[model samples]
Target: MTGISKLLMTLGVIIFVVGFLMQFISLGKLPGDILVKKGNTTFYFPIVTSILISIILSAIFYFIGRFR
Candidate 1:
């Protein structure tokens, strides 16, 4: 890769990391008159969902690359 491409890639990665971390810095419930609420919630597993998506996508790419 060229130097410019490498620099852009590094910047992209830094931005992604910062954006992801900022999510936790929020005071979920501030002096808001009313906090967010949930009702009749079903199973909502984010970790599992992300894991499954990653696994499936990786497997798909692996198979596709096998043909090349």
Candidate 2:
């Protein structure tokens, strides 16, 4: 398969794994994440979770690139 196809497949599998884990883990609700509530209004942002995922993915891709 081509590079784009390989990337998409990797992304799909990552998403699937994350979704499956969400059933047992509370990822987005961690401390340092943002959640706003007002009269009849609500907002949410998983800042910490995003940072954690970015770090993990960065490490993963860094190793992959080093090997390749």
Candidate 3:
């Protein structure tokens, strides 16, 4: 059981890393509006923002698992 758990964790980490790599190569930004007013920026669709966040979270998980 312990070995199985470790294998599953390793597989999860691999998937997360591959996903993170894919997110970095996306073309163009998310499908949303880029608004700049009063020197402030806001996104409407937020696709790019979401992708970045996902990548960060996945990387964090991957490293945490490896270190553990």
Candidate 4:
């Protein structure tokens, strides 16, 4: 397959694996995430989760680039 196709396939597999693992792992509740509750309002932000995913994706892309 071409480079783009290969990259896309790799990403698809990564996404599938992450989705599958999410069922067993609760990344949303990580310690540093923000949660707010008011009388009738609630707000949540997965800041830690976002950072963790960013780091993981960065590492994955770095390896993928190295191998390309």
Error of 3 at 1 (Å): 19
Q: Where does candidate 2 have its weakest 10-residue lDDT segment?
A: 59-68
lDDT of each: 0.57, 0.84, 0.70, 0.92
lDDT for predicted candidate 1 compared with the true structure: 0.57
Using all chains and alpha carbons, the TM-scores for the candidates as numbered come to 0.36, 0.66, 0.38, 0.83
Model 1 bad stretches (over 4 Å): 27-68
Model 2 — TM-score against the truth? 0.66
User: How far in Å is the alpha carbon of 65 misplaced in model 2?
Assistant: 0.5
Candidate 4 C-alpha lDDT tens digits along 1-68: 59889999989998999899889997888999999999999999999999999998899889988988
Output the TM-score of candidate 4.
0.83
Candidate 3: Cα lDDT at 21: 82
**Candidate 2, 1-68: lDDT as tens digits:** 59778778777887798789879987888899999999999999999999998997898688657754
Q: What is residue 5's positional error in candidate 4, in angstroms?
A: 2.0
Name the candidate that leads on lDDT. Answer: 4
1-68: candidate 3 lDDT, tens digit per residue? 89779878887987787679888776445556354445466544656767877897788778867876
Each prediction's number of clashing residue pairs: 0, 0, 0, 0
